[model samples]
Target: MFSTLNWFGWALLSALFAALTAIFAKLGVAQINSDLATLIRTAIVFVLLCLYVAGTRQWSNPLALSGHSWLFLGLSGLATGASWLCYFRALQLGNAAQVAPIDKFSLVLVVIFAVLFLGERPSLREWCGIALIAGGVMVLAFKEQG
Candidate 1:
Protein backbone atom coordinates (compact mmCIF):
# COMPACT_ATOMS: atom_id res chain seq x y z
CA MET A 1 0.00 0.00 0.00
CA PHE A 2 2.81 2.39 0.82
CA SER A 3 4.69 1.40 -2.34
CA THR A 4 2.96 4.07 -4.38
CA LEU A 5 4.45 6.85 -2.30
CA ASN A 6 7.99 7.90 -3.07
CA TRP A 7 10.77 9.07 -0.76
CA PHE A 8 9.88 12.71 -1.28
CA GLY A 9 6.36 12.16 -0.02
CA TRP A 10 7.57 10.49 3.14
CA ALA A 11 10.27 13.11 3.60
CA LEU A 12 7.68 15.87 3.24
CA LEU A 13 5.63 14.34 6.02
CA SER A 14 8.74 14.03 8.18
CA ALA A 15 9.54 17.70 7.59
CA LEU A 16 6.02 18.77 8.52
CA PHE A 17 6.15 16.80 11.77
CA ALA A 18 9.62 18.16 12.53
CA ALA A 19 8.36 21.72 12.22
CA LEU A 20 5.52 20.92 14.59
CA THR A 21 7.94 19.22 17.00
CA ALA A 22 9.99 22.39 17.40
CA ILE A 23 6.88 24.45 18.08
CA PHE A 24 5.48 22.01 20.62
CA ALA A 25 8.83 21.39 22.28
CA LYS A 26 9.53 25.08 22.67
CA LEU A 27 6.19 25.60 24.36
CA GLY A 28 6.68 22.56 26.56
CA VAL A 29 10.21 23.47 27.66
CA ALA A 30 9.32 27.03 28.59
CA GLN A 31 8.58 26.26 32.25
CA ILE A 32 10.80 23.18 32.64
CA ASN A 33 14.45 22.26 32.28
CA SER A 34 15.16 21.38 28.67
CA ASP A 35 16.83 18.11 29.62
CA LEU A 36 13.85 17.05 31.70
CA ALA A 37 11.58 18.11 28.87
CA THR A 38 13.55 15.98 26.43
CA LEU A 39 13.27 13.03 28.78
CA ILE A 40 9.52 13.37 28.92
CA ARG A 41 9.29 13.74 25.17
CA THR A 42 11.45 10.67 24.67
CA ALA A 43 9.33 8.66 27.09
CA ILE A 44 6.24 9.63 25.20
CA VAL A 45 7.83 8.60 21.92
CA PHE A 46 8.97 5.30 23.39
CA VAL A 47 5.49 4.44 24.59
CA LEU A 48 3.89 5.48 21.33
CA LEU A 49 6.33 3.50 19.25
CA CYS A 50 5.87 0.47 21.47
CA LEU A 51 2.14 0.73 21.07
CA TYR A 52 2.54 1.10 17.32
CA VAL A 53 4.69 -2.00 17.04
CA ALA A 54 2.37 -4.04 19.22
CA GLY A 55 -0.70 -2.82 17.43
CA THR A 56 0.87 -3.66 14.09
CA ARG A 57 1.81 -7.13 15.37
CA GLN A 58 5.45 -6.45 14.54
CA TRP A 59 6.86 -7.63 17.86
CA SER A 60 8.21 -10.86 16.48
CA ASN A 61 10.42 -9.24 13.90
CA PRO A 62 13.03 -7.94 16.30
CA LEU A 63 14.35 -11.41 16.98
CA ALA A 64 14.83 -11.81 13.26
CA LEU A 65 16.98 -8.69 12.96
CA SER A 66 20.66 -9.28 12.35
CA GLY A 67 23.47 -8.10 14.62
CA HIS A 68 24.35 -5.35 12.21
CA SER A 69 20.80 -4.03 12.29
CA TRP A 70 20.80 -3.98 16.07
CA LEU A 71 24.16 -2.23 16.22
CA PHE A 72 23.17 0.46 13.72
CA LEU A 73 19.76 0.98 15.28
CA GLY A 74 21.35 1.39 18.68
CA LEU A 75 23.76 3.93 17.29
CA SER A 76 20.89 5.75 15.62
CA GLY A 77 19.02 5.90 18.91
CA LEU A 78 22.03 7.37 20.64
CA ALA A 79 22.39 9.95 17.91
CA THR A 80 18.72 10.84 18.22
CA GLY A 81 18.99 11.32 21.97
CA ALA A 82 22.02 13.57 21.61
CA SER A 83 20.29 15.56 18.89
CA TRP A 84 17.18 16.02 20.98
CA LEU A 85 19.20 17.17 23.97
CA CYS A 86 21.01 19.76 21.89
CA TYR A 87 17.92 20.82 19.99
CA PHE A 88 15.85 21.37 23.11
CA ARG A 89 18.63 23.38 24.74
CA ALA A 90 19.05 25.46 21.62
CA LEU A 91 15.32 26.10 21.45
CA GLN A 92 15.34 27.14 25.07
CA LEU A 93 18.07 29.70 24.38
CA GLY A 94 17.03 30.98 20.96
CA ASN A 95 14.03 31.78 18.82
CA ALA A 96 12.52 28.70 17.20
CA ALA A 97 12.61 30.45 13.83
CA GLN A 98 16.36 30.80 14.09
CA VAL A 99 17.13 27.49 15.74
CA ALA A 100 14.99 25.30 13.53
CA PRO A 101 16.58 26.50 10.32
CA ILE A 102 20.02 25.95 11.74
CA ASP A 103 18.99 22.51 12.95
CA LYS A 104 17.95 21.66 9.42
CA PHE A 105 21.47 22.40 8.24
CA SER A 106 21.82 18.66 8.82
CA LEU A 107 20.41 18.25 5.34
CA VAL A 108 23.64 19.51 3.81
CA LEU A 109 25.61 17.13 5.96
CA VAL A 110 23.32 14.30 4.99
CA VAL A 111 24.10 14.83 1.32
CA ILE A 112 27.81 14.67 1.99
CA PHE A 113 27.54 11.60 4.22
CA ALA A 114 25.35 9.83 1.72
CA VAL A 115 27.98 10.28 -0.92
CA LEU A 116 30.97 9.46 1.26
CA PHE A 117 29.63 6.57 3.34
CA LEU A 118 26.67 5.21 1.46
CA GLY A 119 28.41 5.50 -1.90
CA GLU A 120 25.27 7.03 -3.37
CA ARG A 121 25.74 9.13 -6.48
CA PRO A 122 23.78 12.32 -6.61
CA SER A 123 23.29 14.29 -9.80
CA LEU A 124 24.46 17.84 -10.40
CA ARG A 125 20.99 19.18 -9.59
CA GLU A 126 20.99 17.43 -6.22
CA TRP A 127 24.43 18.81 -5.42
CA CYS A 128 23.18 22.29 -6.33
CA GLY A 129 20.23 21.83 -4.01
CA ILE A 130 22.55 20.79 -1.21
CA ALA A 131 24.65 23.89 -1.81
CA LEU A 132 21.56 26.04 -1.72
CA ILE A 133 20.53 24.49 1.61
CA ALA A 134 23.99 25.20 3.00
CA GLY A 135 23.79 28.79 1.81
CA GLY A 136 20.36 29.20 3.35
CA VAL A 137 21.64 27.82 6.66
CA MET A 138 24.48 30.31 6.66
CA VAL A 139 22.11 33.17 5.87
CA LEU A 140 19.64 32.16 8.55
CA ALA A 141 22.22 31.45 11.24
CA PHE A 142 23.92 34.83 10.79
CA LYS A 143 22.79 37.43 13.32
CA GLU A 144 23.43 41.13 12.84
CA GLN A 145 24.20 43.12 15.98
CA GLY A 146 22.92 46.63 16.05
Candidate 2:
Protein backbone atom coordinates (compact mmCIF):
# COMPACT_ATOMS: atom_id res chain seq x y z
CA MET A 1 0.00 0.00 0.00
CA PHE A 2 2.78 2.36 0.95
CA SER A 3 4.79 1.57 -2.14
CA THR A 4 2.50 3.36 -4.59
CA LEU A 5 3.19 6.88 -3.41
CA ASN A 6 6.48 8.60 -3.97
CA TRP A 7 8.56 8.85 -0.81
CA PHE A 8 7.98 12.62 -0.66
CA GLY A 9 4.27 12.14 -0.02
CA TRP A 10 4.99 9.78 2.81
CA ALA A 11 7.39 12.27 4.38
CA LEU A 12 4.88 15.08 4.02
CA LEU A 13 2.14 13.11 5.69
CA SER A 14 4.41 12.07 8.52
CA ALA A 15 5.50 15.65 9.09
CA LEU A 16 1.90 16.86 9.07
CA PHE A 17 0.94 14.28 11.64
CA ALA A 18 3.87 15.18 13.85
CA ALA A 19 3.03 18.88 13.68
CA LEU A 20 -0.61 18.33 14.56
CA THR A 21 0.22 15.83 17.27
CA ALA A 22 2.46 18.34 19.03
CA ILE A 23 -0.26 20.95 19.02
CA PHE A 24 -2.97 18.60 20.28
CA ALA A 25 -0.74 16.91 22.82
CA LYS A 26 0.33 20.23 24.25
CA LEU A 27 -3.29 21.18 24.81
CA GLY A 28 -4.02 17.76 26.26
CA VAL A 29 -1.04 17.67 28.63
CA ALA A 30 -1.98 21.06 30.04
CA GLN A 31 -4.84 19.42 31.93
CA ILE A 32 -3.15 16.14 32.82
CA ASN A 33 0.13 14.54 33.76
CA SER A 34 2.19 13.53 30.75
CA ASP A 35 2.15 9.87 31.80
CA LEU A 36 -1.63 9.72 32.08
CA ALA A 37 -2.04 11.61 28.85
CA THR A 38 0.37 9.25 27.14
CA LEU A 39 -1.58 6.32 28.51
CA ILE A 40 -4.82 7.65 27.10
CA ARG A 41 -3.30 8.33 23.72
CA THR A 42 -1.63 4.92 23.63
CA ALA A 43 -4.89 3.24 24.54
CA ILE A 44 -6.66 4.96 21.69
CA VAL A 45 -3.91 4.08 19.23
CA PHE A 46 -3.92 0.50 20.47
CA VAL A 47 -7.65 0.22 19.94
CA LEU A 48 -7.33 1.62 16.46
CA LEU A 49 -4.49 -0.72 15.58
CA CYS A 50 -6.36 -3.69 16.97
CA LEU A 51 -9.41 -2.74 14.95
CA TYR A 52 -7.30 -2.49 11.82
CA VAL A 53 -5.73 -5.85 12.50
CA ALA A 54 -9.12 -7.45 13.05
CA GLY A 55 -10.59 -5.80 9.98
CA THR A 56 -7.71 -7.03 7.83
CA ARG A 57 -7.50 -10.37 9.68
CA GLN A 58 -3.76 -9.90 9.74
CA TRP A 59 -3.78 -11.05 13.33
CA SER A 60 -4.05 -14.61 12.08
CA ASN A 61 -0.89 -14.35 10.01
CA PRO A 62 1.56 -14.33 12.87
CA LEU A 63 3.03 -17.58 11.66
CA ALA A 64 3.97 -15.99 8.37
CA LEU A 65 6.59 -13.83 10.02
CA SER A 66 10.04 -15.27 10.41
CA GLY A 67 11.60 -15.31 13.88
CA HIS A 68 13.93 -12.46 12.93
CA SER A 69 11.03 -10.44 11.60
CA TRP A 70 9.08 -10.98 14.81
CA LEU A 71 12.09 -9.96 16.89
CA PHE A 72 12.53 -6.74 14.91
CA LEU A 73 8.83 -5.95 15.14
CA GLY A 74 8.82 -6.46 18.88
CA LEU A 75 11.89 -4.30 19.33
CA SER A 76 10.46 -1.57 17.15
CA GLY A 77 7.23 -1.59 19.16
CA LEU A 78 9.16 -1.37 22.42
CA ALA A 79 11.21 1.53 21.12
CA THR A 80 8.08 3.40 20.03
CA GLY A 81 6.54 2.87 23.46
CA ALA A 82 9.68 4.19 25.12
CA SER A 83 9.69 7.21 22.83
CA TRP A 84 6.09 8.07 23.73
CA LEU A 85 6.94 7.86 27.42
CA CYS A 86 9.86 10.25 27.00
CA TYR A 87 7.85 12.61 24.81
CA PHE A 88 5.07 12.87 27.36
CA ARG A 89 7.50 13.38 30.18
CA ALA A 90 9.19 16.17 28.29
CA LEU A 91 5.88 17.85 27.51
CA GLN A 92 4.91 17.65 31.16
CA LEU A 93 8.07 19.49 32.14
CA GLY A 94 8.27 21.94 29.23
CA ASN A 95 6.15 23.78 26.72
CA ALA A 96 5.11 21.81 23.68
CA ALA A 97 6.39 24.51 21.40
CA GLN A 98 9.85 23.93 22.80
CA VAL A 99 9.65 20.19 23.00
CA ALA A 100 8.41 19.78 19.45
CA PRO A 101 11.35 21.57 17.86
CA ILE A 102 13.83 19.59 19.90
CA ASP A 103 12.00 16.42 19.00
CA LYS A 104 12.17 17.40 15.35
CA PHE A 105 15.93 17.18 15.58
CA SER A 106 15.45 13.44 15.43
CA LEU A 107 15.30 13.88 11.67
CA VAL A 108 18.94 14.84 11.69
CA LEU A 109 19.76 11.85 13.82
CA VAL A 110 17.78 9.63 11.48
CA VAL A 111 19.80 10.85 8.53
CA ILE A 112 22.96 9.94 10.36
CA PHE A 113 21.61 6.50 11.24
CA ALA A 114 20.54 5.93 7.66
CA VAL A 115 24.05 6.63 6.48
CA LEU A 116 25.57 4.34 9.08
CA PHE A 117 23.15 1.42 9.21
CA LEU A 118 21.27 1.56 5.92
CA GLY A 119 24.26 2.73 3.91
CA GLU A 120 21.99 5.25 2.28
CA ARG A 121 23.81 8.38 1.24
CA PRO A 122 21.67 11.44 0.68
CA SER A 123 21.91 13.30 -2.60
CA LEU A 124 22.80 16.98 -2.73
CA ARG A 125 19.17 18.02 -3.08
CA GLU A 126 18.21 15.97 -0.07
CA TRP A 127 21.05 17.42 1.92
CA CYS A 128 19.86 20.92 1.03
CA GLY A 129 16.39 20.03 2.25
CA ILE A 130 17.85 18.71 5.48
CA ALA A 131 19.73 21.97 5.90
CA LEU A 132 16.52 23.90 5.42
CA ILE A 133 14.76 21.68 7.90
CA ALA A 134 17.47 22.31 10.44
CA GLY A 135 17.20 26.05 9.88
CA GLY A 136 13.44 25.91 10.28
CA VAL A 137 13.81 23.98 13.49
CA MET A 138 16.23 26.55 14.84
CA VAL A 139 13.79 29.29 14.05
CA LEU A 140 10.98 27.50 15.88
CA ALA A 141 13.18 26.82 18.87
CA PHE A 142 13.91 30.51 19.30
CA LYS A 143 10.44 31.82 18.53
CA GLU A 144 9.70 32.92 22.08
CA GLN A 145 12.91 34.85 22.53
CA GLY A 146 12.09 37.43 19.92
TM-score, cand. 2: 0.81
Residue-level lDDT tens digits of model 2 in 1-146:
77597889898889899889888888888888888998999999999999999998768778888999999899989988898989888877887887898888888879988999999999999989888888888888776645
Clashing pairs in 1: none
Error of 2 at 91 (Å): 1.9
List runs of model 2 lying over 4 Å from the truth. 1-7, 143-146
| Clash totals, every prediction | 0, 0
Best candidate according to TM-score: 1
Clashes of 2: 0
Cα lDDT for residue 93, model 2? Answer: 80
Query: Which lDDT tens digits does candidate 1 get at residues 79-112?
Result: 9999999999999999998999999999988888
lDDT measured at residue 64 in model 2 versus the true structure, 0 to 100: 84
lDDT of 2 at 121: 97
